[model samples]
Target: MSTQNVAERAVIREARPEDDAAIGELLVEAFITQYAKKLPEVVYTDERKRELRDVAARRKVATILVAEVDGEVVGTVALFPPGAPGSEAWLPNSADLRGLATAVRFHGTGLAKPLLDAAEDLARKWGVDAICLHVRKGAEGVGRLYMKRGFVREPVGDMDLPSVFLTAYVKPLK
Candidate 1:
């Protein structure tokens, strides 16, 4: 299929309760596949699994968008105020797009870009002046994707982990 066809086949919309299990599984599978080679396998363990699963089921509390193809969910993301992504850090009036993941089969299928674009739009509708996100400090590749999408690196907040640090970025929507 042509690249445009693949992108066009994907539909971006709000997630539903019935999608919890699929969303959870996709998050774990996609995240591990992308980061396992670069980071230690131990970090992607049971606790992490449970966390992703629980977070998926709770997406209703905020704006969670899912990408679907031919009726199957292929990716997901959410927009919330700061500190909603299990972090205590706060960025007032900014909606932080978090919990993003794409199914392995759908990687590079343009699913994530539109999901992000939708999240930014949601942020604007919610009256937030900016949209924000966080990435592992050493994850320059992941950070580059956000940078290319208009997010600017922010010097505030740090999520210090044993294996890596987390840094924040923001894209002005006002």
Candidate 2:
């Protein structure tokens, strides 16, 4: 599908190796706003930044899609293959969706919906039975979007991050 059709000003396409840097930049910018002083500095350091960029470049079992406007990336979403290693163990039966970010400038533009639509479409194509994602507390807007998109919240429990209350959102693919 043509990216222009989704959003008049943005184009959605599969992320390429060259997009690693741009995607990493977007991640840092987007996360910093939500995480602010709470997130560790190392998470945004050059080395760890490169690691994220590399992950986007490798693609691995995770499919990363980007949204660009006037040749600049403004949003991104990633869907990992079911059963992929390091996948969210809490939702072992579901495909893991990650790195859903949109440039702050693009906020209220509905750019995120198309990115998510692409992820869900890709997940269905991969024969995934369900989709799962983690949203930190205080990110009510993000959670509400997923809820509106048909995702239901599962119980919170053991996880890597604390008080962050790993809220698992799931949506059946089939």
Candidate 3:
């Protein structure tokens, strides 16, 4: 199908319990598969995979949003309130966004934008002054999307994890 058609028909909504497995699969495919080349194989430990697959665990702390195309889950993103565990939000009154992943087949189909829009809208509704997120430094394409959407790179917030380096980005809502 055409990119435009796929994007036009996609629905962005809060994920239901039944979506847990699909979201987990999408996250693993989008992250581990793509980052394996740039990151060390050791990073793909079973524990890490389990962490990526734990959508229900994340749902307890964040609002899990998914994009469904014709009844198939194709994309997912997590929006976390400030002070929530695993939240990298440093700016006061900011929300944290993470796990923005799209299925390989849906890459470049403009699906991420809607997921991001929904997160930003939810952030505004929650009275946050900004939305913060971390992107793997090697994921230039994903970083570009955030930059294009007005997320400013905050080098001071960059993190050097044992397996991967992350660059922080923040977009002010005010």
Candidate 4:
């Protein structure tokens, strides 16, 4: 699939074990920037970084996916099956979707939409009726994108940080 970015020309697919490092890099880059602006107190330490890498390597969810362009990883999104052991507020009554990250260099080139589409396809394949995610209230742009794609907001409580209410968004897959 040709994209506006000449360097990107591929479809999204399941993430391979070998992609853990690349995926970790993408996540660190994307989240570091976002968290720096949103939640400066959220420290991304070495242990936390290793934990994320380990999760990516193990592929515990069976739904981790990555988008590659010309053999270079560009973006990724994963749908955690319902009943997973986690306290993610957005995930209540739905499959928890997380780890939506893209290479810093590939932002604003429309790669995210395709990644999300692939994630939704996986959720449907797993027989999940709905998929959900959380976005910080300050990140209105991110929330708007999900809203535009048919996601509706659900009530969520404030997290540990003030002014950072967890805005849960859900999209019905059925």
Candidate 3 to truth, TM: 0.92
lDDT of each residue in 56-169, candidate 3, tens digit only? 999999999998888899999999998898888888889999999999888878898888888899999999999999988777777888999999999987889877788999
Backbone clashes for every candidate come to 0, 0, 0, 0
lDDT for each candidate structure: 0.77, 0.75, 0.88, 0.73
Which candidate, 3 or 4, would have the higher lDDT against the true structure? 3
Tens-place lDDT per residue, model 1, 1-174, is: 234555578789998888888888898998888887655543677887897887554674566789888788888987775545443324777776778898887677777888888888787777878887788766788888899999888877556767667888878887
If scored against the real structure, what TM-score would every candidate get? 0.88, 0.81, 0.92, 0.81
For model 4, the superposed segments whose C-alpha errors exceed 4 Å read 1-3, 6-8, 37-43, 87-93, 156-165
RMSD of each: 2.4, 4.1, 1.8, 3.4
In candidate 2, the residue pairs with backbone N, CA or C atoms under 3 Å apart (3 or more residues apart, or in different chains) clash, namely none
Q: Write candidate 2's Cα lDDT for 1-174 as tens digits.
A: 234433566778999888888898888778777566444432455765565666554487678899988788889988877787667735545788888888876766788888888888888887878898888765667789899999887755224463345667888877
lDDT of 4 by residue, 1-174 (tens): 344663346468888888878888888888788777767766678876776666554476546788888888878877777776553634445677778877777777778888888788777877877887888766777888889989888765334444346677888877
lDDT of 3 at 129: 92
Query: For model 3, what is the error of residue 37's alpha carbon versus the real structure, in angstroms, after optimal superposition?
Result: 5.5
Give the RMSD in angstroms, all C-alphas superposed, for model 2.
Answer: 4.1
As for candidate 3, its clashing pairs are none
Ranked by lDDT, the better of candidates 1 and 3 is 3
